[model samples]
Target: MKQIRLGLYQFGDRLIMRARHDWIVWTLVTAEGQARWREERRFPLTVTAAGIVRDLLAS
Candidate 1:
């Protein structure tokens, strides 16, 4: 199995996740931030980042 590592940080009021694969950095925002973003457009609230990585890996 290959090991994967992620770096997490907070910027202002947002949580950011960063992972490096090869020479590229992949960035993802916490679910709450995403929700707020959607809410700005009048979209319904949805899942957060709490279980996002697990859910994606399980799928």
Candidate 2:
């Protein structure tokens, strides 16, 4: 089974943050945390359009 850990951090302007450990995935749904990842702007490590939509609907 796959496990995911989500956390929040301080950053600038985005909406979520994703982090991974060993084989587990984590998503930090917050403005500051998201902003940090966005500013980095990396592809494979970046946010997914579909994921954002799914999260919105779930929320």
Best by TM-score: 2
Give lDDT tens digits, candidate 2, residues 1-59.
22233343434433434443212233334553332323222343225665566668889
For model 1, the stretches where C-alpha displacement exceeds 4 angstroms are 1-46
lDDT of each: 0.35, 0.40
- lDDT for each residue of candidate 1 in 1-59, tens digit (9 for 90 to 100): 22223333334434333333212223335545542221111211223443465568778
- Model 1 Cα shift for residue 2 (angstroms): 41
Clashing pairs in 2: 14-35, 16-34
Each candidate structure's TM-score, on Cα atoms with residue i matched to residue i, is 0.20, 0.23
After TM-score superposition, the amount by which residue 59's alpha carbon in candidate 2 deviates from its true location, in angstroms, is 0.4
RMSD of 2: 12.1
- Which 10-residue span in candidate 2 carries the lowest summed lDDT? 37-46
